[model samples]
Target: MNSQDETQIAVLRNLYAKQAHLIDTGQHEGWAQTFTADGEFHSPTYGEPAIGHDQLADISRRFSESAQQAGERHRHVIENIWVTECDGSSAQVRAYVMIVGTDIERKQARILRIVTNIDQLEKSADGWLIRHRKVEY
Candidate 1:
């Protein structure tokens, strides 16, 4: 890989890290900003795909609120991330996600779900933004 390619991969990896931290800390709005304006998040866990930043924010907020109400702590562990393909303007990436959750009553955290994320990212004026993210079991 060329230096530019490596840099792009690094950026995408950082993006994943930022996304995990933002969602884990209940920063839904900030997390939403990681996507493009018309970005989409598709997850079987969510029932339907969340389209656009507005919908993404709503879904994220719902998840955050639900977790808060249940006194649940969630940690999104992203690993085995790889950039499968990259053009100058776009890339395809994949990663494994393991969600660990702990209830307030229980001090121990346990694995809740494991899935793989397939993502399409595009280079935007601001920076690289996620155009579509599909989560699969």
Candidate 2:
């Protein structure tokens, strides 16, 4: 791979890590900003795909609230990330996600789900943003 590819890959890796941190910390708005303005997220567990940043933020907020209400914690382990394709301005990425859920009261944590995330990313003025993300369990 060329240096440019290496740099892009690094940036993509950082993006994934940042995304996980945002979600884990319940930074819903910050997490939503990782997406493009018109980005879409498809999750089987979420009932329907969330389209656009507003919808995405709403979903994030709902999830955060639900977890908080239940006294639960979520940690998303993103691993095995592969940049399947990359151009100067866009890339296709796939990664495995393992969500660990913790019960604050019981101080117990367990793997809640495992899935593969396929993301379509684009380079915008703000840097790389997710154009679409489809989650497969």
Query: Highest TM-score, which number?
Result: 2
Q: Give the Å shift of residue 107 in candidate 1.
A: 1.8
Tens-digit lDDT track of model 2 for 34-122: 99999999999797999988899887887777778878998889999999999979999999999888999999998889999999999
In candidate 2 the C-alpha lDDT for residue 19 amounts to 94
Cα-based lDDT at residue 84, candidate 2: 99
Question: Tens digits of per-residue lDDT for model 1 on 8-108?
Answer: 88988999999999988878888998999999999998888999888898878877877778788888999999899999799899999998888878787
- Candidate 1 has which clashing residue pairs, if any? none
TM-score of 1: 0.94
Question: Which predicted model would earn the best lDDT?
Answer: 2
Q: Model 2, residue 7: what's the lDDT?
A: 94
